[model samples]
Target: MREEVNMPLNLEEKKELVKEVSDVLLNADTILTADYRGLTANQLTEFRKIARTPGIYIKIVKNNMLKMALKDSEYAVISDKISGPQILATASDNPGEFAKLVKKFIDNNENIELKSLAYKGKELDLSEIKKLATLPTYEEAISMLMSIMQAPVQKLMATMTAVPTKMVRTLDAVKGTKN
Candidate 1:
């Protein structure tokens, strides 16, 4: 039986990979690192499918290559979290949504463990990441704000109309009693 040899990436390929990852990092609002040691290939594929949103990127690269890509980038702080069969997930915007997705995946898959996450150049632990996951999306936040802003006006309108409504009801009761 012949053993197949594993070819290492050449210098140019390494440079290209670094450049690609750097480009993704440049636009990322949130970066997450997770240990994917025990997940099956199918689980990983399912994760990729779930992460296939427009602004989200997920990749499994060598730690050294990812470190090289993270160098000098805002996400460099996350380099310490990159170790031992890790998966990288980044989002260009709506970091809360990305966090929610990762949180859901982690909840469903026992083998996957979240290591660390960086947002706007700050490193956050798992608990902080969980809090982030519960944040509302942009549209949801806007809707909530609108509701809050509209509440007083709605109450005022209802209050203004209530006096006339009560008056009409009192007159109707008087007419019935008189009959």
Candidate 2:
């Protein structure tokens, strides 16, 4: 089916769209791009529903508009992959969780193609994105590290308490014998 051409956005709307995209770029902790042209409307809706969770965002952008919006930003590096229709996915604080979610959908659909992923001033390929998806969530990773760090301290405290406990037990036994 021939696609109906969308009327060009006027200068003002274009400017607004650019700003909107710029805000997304500045706020996202990690960003990923994928080819989304093959997703059906229902699939897109389901994708949007999944994306509505906190720290996750999904956008299907007009390639040219995104190019204009990403200029001078770190996201500009990804513009090269924006040659055709694309899906822009972002995570504000939980990049691993976001990657996992997006990858789940991508795995389910054969048509969905990962283009690129960006995080912390670095551009990554689909393989890296897969690695990212397997990572523990930020909070989980932090807690796991904290537990590892605290293990020695916890053991030290228990040992210290054991000495005092043994002394008290010894004193009590001696007192019982005297009585």
Candidate 3:
């Protein structure tokens, strides 16, 4: 029989990890919890690389460690779902963009399972999370709004000038005909 070697984190390291998690959660706009079981090491490495975008961070922690970190957080609501192999994704961006990131990961990896998403102090169910994923990012929404706002003004300006333009062309035609 082979004996297993386990070197658990020392008190200091645990404290550091806990503090880091708490701080990340505190500053995050949204947190997504997912199970990363059955994913290969290579797959995880690739996923991590993809997740290195701005405003996103991922931590895979034991349930106990995560619970300790969540103790004083508005994210305490999700502490109950902390069991099993998990990934804690904290995003500093708007919730929609974070949802897009998580949804992208979920779509690429079959082993990754979406558990729950926390945003605005509320725990969103899976369906709500999916809907959020489909939403446009802050930039996209802003551009869409700008285009919508500009369209009407542009049309009004074009229409206002078109009448004068047509009248000028009509007078030019009449003068040429008389000549």
* Top-TM-score candidate index: 1
Candidate order by lDDT, decreasing, is 1, 3, 2
Q: Write the per-residue lDDT of candidate 1 for residues 59-96, one digit (tens) a residue.
A: 98889999999987998888887889989999998988
In model 1, state the lDDT of residue 159. 100
Question: Which pairs clash inside model 2?
Answer: none
Query: 1-179 in candidate 2: lDDT tens per residue?
Result: 12556776778877787788888888888888888778899988888887789978788878888888778677788778887788777888877888888888888988888888899657887788788888899789999999999999999999999999999999999999999
* Residue 57 displacement in candidate 1 (angstroms): 0.7
Candidate 2 stretches greater than 4 Å from native: 1-8, 161-179
Q: Model 3: C-alpha RMSD to truth?
A: 4.1
On lDDT, the candidate that comes out on top is 1
Residue 48 accuracy (lDDT) in model 3: 76
Give the lDDT of residue 122 in candidate 3. 82
The pairs that clash in candidate 3 are: none
TM-score ranking of the models: 1, 3, 2
| Model 2 accuracy (lDDT, Cα) | 0.83
